[model samples]
Target chain A: MLDLLRLLSFGPDGWGDEIAQGALLTIELALATLPVGIAIGLMIALAKDSSSAILRGLGNLYTTIFRGLPELLTLFIVYYGGQMLLTELAEHFVEGAHVEVNQFVAGVVALGLVLGAFSSEVLLAAIRAVPKGQKEAAAALGLSGWRTFRLVTFPQLWRVALPGLSNNWMVLLKDTSLVSVIAISDLMRQTAIAVGVTKQPFFFYLVACLIYLVFSGASSVVFGKLEDRAARGFKRVGGH
Target chain B: MELLHAIGDGFLSVVGHLGLNTELMERYGPRFLDGVWVTLKLVGISVFLGALLALPLAVARVEGGKFLSRLAFGYSYFFRGTPLLAQTFLVYYGAGQFREQLTDIGLWWFFRDAFNCAVFTFTLNTAAYQSEILRGGIQSLPAGQVEAAFSLGLSRFLAYRKVVLPQAIAIGLRPLGNELILMIKSSAIASVITVYDLMGVTRLAFSRSYDMEVYLWAAVLYLLMVEVVRRVWDVLERRLNRHLLISR
Candidate 1:
């Protein structure tokens, strides 16, 4: 036990610092992807909800492709394919130019695209669940479409969407580990490095698992609190 | 034969128009086929074994005494709480740390193979998820159904086998299909451990040709597989629930 503690300690002989930094990066990657993902999700939801057939088809196509493909494949495409596309565009515009996609940014974009695809489904459902009469009432009160959505629909939409969004958040948090495959030095990769040096794969990998469990467990608690807060003004139905 | 040849050529032309580089397909086509076979075998075996393991555990969670229920809950909680990649790594690489003990116990051979490790890890992971789905299915049945079965003079085992399980499975069919889809997507991670699944072969092709199109092709193949499964699941669900369907 003492030996294990020393091995994971923060001093010179330990790999604690490296693992800690990796954990921080994992959280950072998930946090950075959250808003980008939600924004894309909102856009797709609106597009699907729109009257234009073309936009609706495009929205469905986007979600179907992204959600169907494996997250790792999406990451590879965004990392390698995005670089190729960007380089071609850059060279076309400038006489001589090169662009390299950052691993972190690639991670964010790929994960965001996937999360957006899924969350759009949730957001679309929530948007539809809002009473049509609410929008009509807002219009009767002289509210514009955007204003009605903002002042009347948005709050209720989030309350309904929160549970599904929270599930997506958990998935995103776990999916961030895939970025380690592209050498981002995320928590999984950091643990791999530690295992390599210490020749203690079991210990280090178990440590990584515990760290992930802690994050997920804490996330569940926090989301539970948020759900309660979201339900503050509502009456419980069916004794739930 | 001549008509078939013409159709093939037209297909090639369309693929070329889509910028898929038919020449690369010619070179790597057989290898990709092998990769698909391996991926299918890996996922098929794991999900099959996982469902087998999950049924009893799900029963334990839903109907077992307190100790068994808690034991099953802890297992599900740990597996579901962590990333599958971490679980795979822990099994694959961690086996090395136990080489001597495993060798002494005569189990080293099983742990030594990458494919075996991948299958083992995936089986455990999917079993956890499947148990939760099954547990939900079992619980969602009205309490009166089980009580009615008891009143009919059925034993506990008969009640479950003849009455409860069929309905629970029917209710859980959609989520079970979703879980299967999720498994297919996640089984790509087996490539990370050198299991040579579709993604693994794509990685190899990419390294050799430096072409990004192989990934696109792989993505298309994955999408097709997902679509086919979704459709099949839909048909199966309809067939199973035909009695519940309202006549027009």
Candidate 2:
């Protein structure tokens, strides 16, 4: 036990600091991707809900393509394909300018696109679950469309969307491990490096798994509380 | 073989019309086909084996005694809570840490192969997800269905085999399809451990030519596979639930 502690300790002889940094980077990547994914998902949801057939078709196409493709494949496309495209643009516009897509940015965009595709489904369901009469009542009160959505629809959307979105967040948290493939020093990659040096693959990988479990377990608790808070002031209709 | 050749020619002609690089396709096309076969074998074997393991685990979760239920719960929870990639690493590389003990047990050969490790890890991982799906399907049935089976002079095992499982499976078909699709996508991670699935071939092809089009082709192939599965699953679901449909 003491040997294990020393191996995981934060000093020249140990890998604790590197693993800690990797854990922080993993959290940072997930946090950075959250708003981008949610915003894109919201737009896609609205697009699917729109009256225009073109907009609806485009939304369906986006979700179908992104959700169908593997997340690793998406990452490769963004990392390599995005770099290729940017380099071409840069060379064309500015004489001999070089461009390399940042790994962190590529990870965020790739994972965000995937999360958007999935969350749109959840968000679209929640948007539809809001009673249509609420909007009509708001309109009858002379409220503008935006005001009606803000005052009446948005509040209830959270209550309905929270559980599905929480599930997505857990998935996103796990998917962040894939970014380690693109040479980002996320927790998984850091642990891999530690395993390489220490020759203790089981120890390091098991530790990595435990860290991830802690994050996910904490997330479940936090989301549970959020669901409760969202449910406050709403009357229970049927079951206990 | 002649029919396959004809299909290949037709595909090449389509690629030509699309103005894609035909030379790249000509060189890497066979490799990609091989990759597809590998991917299919990986997902197919693992999902089938996983489902087998899952049925019992699901039964344990929903119908077994307290000790069995808790054991199943812990197994499912551990696999579900962590990233599959991490689980893969733990199994693949962690095997090295136990080389001596495994050698003594004469099981080192199994862990020594990357493909075997991938299959084993994927089997365990998908079993957890599948068990949860099965549990949900089982629990979702109205309680009276089971009671009716018992009241019909059917034994406990007979009731489950003849009545409960069929209904649970029918209810769970869509989710099982979704799970299969997810497994197809997740199988790509096996490439990181050197399994040469579709993604592995794409990576190798990319390193050689550095052409972005290879990834595009891969994306198209994956999309086609997912679309095919989705359509087939839709038809199957309808067929299975035909009795549930209201008559026009």
Candidate 3:
């Protein structure tokens, strides 16, 4: 009993501090990747919806390649392959570019790339869900391309897209644990370390599970609030 | 030059290991084949065990004693909320601490290995999800039909089997199949615990070859597994729903 308390303490000797830091790293990792994912996803979505055949082909390839690959395999490709490619480019481009992919950058890029593939689906669906008449009306009003997208399309897209996007966020948050395998020392990695170092697997792991519950629960609550807000002023005209 | 050289050497080594650029093919066909066999066994057994355990557990949660319901709820929340990796560790390395008690109960031998532990965690994890799915399916059945079943002198068991189970299984088939595919992907997580399933074996092959060619071979194996299951499920779902398709 006392051992459990000691393990969770805040003192210098306690491992509680490390666990907290791990949680923070996981959060930071997700935050960093989330924006990258959203930007890449929107670009891919637009590319997929682009009138040009070349643009549509690029988007299809982007989603197909990443989506078809396993997340773990994708992680390995980014971590190992990214390093190999970056180092090679550095040697040629800048004598000694010293550009190495660290854990955070690797984790962000790996997770971000995969998330971009999935979120492209979400964004594309959102873009399509807008009543076609809205775009037609915008064009009829002489609003140009960017103006049509900016004024009429994008805002409606987010409101419609937020639910599915947030659902993807919850998944992305959970999957961040995969980054730990690549040596990112996030929550799961830290728990693995503490378990190995302490030799108290159940204690540390149960703590880890509790932490997940708190975080996942909090995320769902936030998602629920966002869904509610985004759903404002939109009532279903048909079946519930 | 090394980049070009690595690609050259990588391709040759990859192909030389097999005949006619059939790399995984001539590498002596059975290694991954056996790994896939074990993977399917792992998934099939765990899904079976999880479903069996979840049915009673779900019953306990929904209509059993109050304390039991809460206990089941706690178990569901904890297992479902956490990452699967943590659960795997708790079973593998964590079991070592309780060696004596497990041995005392003649269970240490079972807990001694990584495969057993991975299966155990997978079983428990899916059982929780299964229970929730079953519970939802049960609650969604029309109360009027149930009442009619009772009035016709059918016991609860008979009613569920004859009436509820059929409709539930119909509504549940697609979602359940999706879960099965997710489980197949999830079985890869067992690699972390050192079980050497398909992913672990692929990781080993990759480390030596350092060419992702071997890993690509592994992905094809996975895709085939997923596709086979998907096709079989399509047939089964169709057979079951022919009544709906035929229409009155």
TM-score per candidate: 0.95, 0.96, 0.86
Query: Global lDDT for candidate 1?
Result: 0.93
Q: Distance from true position, residue B222, model 3, in Å?
A: 2.2
Candidate 1 local lDDT, A6-86, one digit each (tens): 888886899999999999999999999999999999999999999999999999999999989999999999999999899
DockQ of each: 0.89, 0.88, 0.51
The candidate maximizing TM-score is: 2
Which ranking of candidates, highest TM-score first? 2, 1, 3
Off by over 4 Å in 2: B1-10, B246-248
Tens-digit per-residue lDDT, A116-172, candidate 3: 988999999998999999999999999999999997887788788998888678768
Every candidate's lDDT = 0.93, 0.94, 0.81
Candidate 1 - chain A - TM: 0.95
Segments in model 3 whose C-alpha atoms lie over 4 Å from true places: A43-68, A88-99, A138-152, A236-240, B1-29, B58-69
